[model samples]
Target: MRFALNHIATPKLSLADFLGLARRLGMPAIEIRNDLPDVVGTMPAGAVRAAAVASGVDILSINALYPFNVWSGDVPARALALVDYAQACGARALVMCPLNDGTPVPHGDLVAALRELVPILRQYGITGLVEPLGFPVSSLRTKREAIEAIREAGASDVCKLVHDTFHHHL
Candidate 1:
């Protein structure tokens, strides 16, 4: 299997520096986080793309879009923007987390949310990596729940579960 490191590993490093380290360490891929100090989210897409090309490192995925499913009026537009950003950055997938907004989102609502978002993901040729946060307030707390939502949304081809080990044990 190919090895990949999350941007969290070197939060303060520039994208170019991080890519250099990944190449030196022989990692085939790296996950970029929009929240990182000096990286994709803040940098211009051309710059990020240039850095990735120069380093010869494959971008596996973008770290995340918060409460991706239950998007409000402008949230879906923001998500689309992120999807475009991911595509421009040569990233294959967009990681999406369930609602962690401290309100209990019903299972039906969760399914509805996924249904609404999956089409947007497919339109951009982006994979939706649904991550379940096992927090008490999180609507989705297990891979099974995410899977069920994907199934319910009829988006199995575009939506997949992302099991975060740390959250899985919580």
Candidate 2:
């Protein structure tokens, strides 16, 4: 099986050091995180792009655009910004995680969000990797619901699922 490091595993490492670690470990790809301190946090997109090129490690995705299924207000703006960042950094996809905060977002609303994002992702030449949270409080607690939303949105070509083993066991 192939392996890619998620930056969350080493939140303390500088991007350079993290890339070095990936190279040292023979990993061709890595998932950078915005949630981690000083990782993708406030780094200029071009610098991140240059760092990826210098390190010779492919960025799998900007792991992630959070609460992506909630499509209105600031969410769309943030998603577009993340997509631009993903494209700029030569990442193949944007890891789109659903709202996990107990409160349920309607099924139709989720599908609508996917349909809305599908075109933006395609326009930026990036894929959207939907990662369902299986925690009891998660709004979309299973991959089945995410799959149904994708299907209903007719976005299979532009989107895919990230099967998080830890979440699967939840």
Q: What are the models' TM-scores?
A: 0.92, 0.95
Clashing pairs in 1: none
Instruction: Give lDDT: candidate 2, residue 100.
Output: 88
- What lDDT would candidate 2 get against the real structure? 0.88
Off by over 4 Å in 2: none
List RMSD in Å for every model shown: 1.6, 1.2
The lDDT for every candidate, in the order shown, is: 0.83, 0.88
* Alpha-carbon deviation at 32 in model 1, angstroms: 0.8
lDDT of 1 by residue, 21-105 (tens): 9999999798998776536558876777778888899888887888776768776877888889888888888889877868877
Give the per-residue Cα lDDT of candidate 2 at 44. Answer: 86
Question: TM-score for model 1?
Answer: 0.92
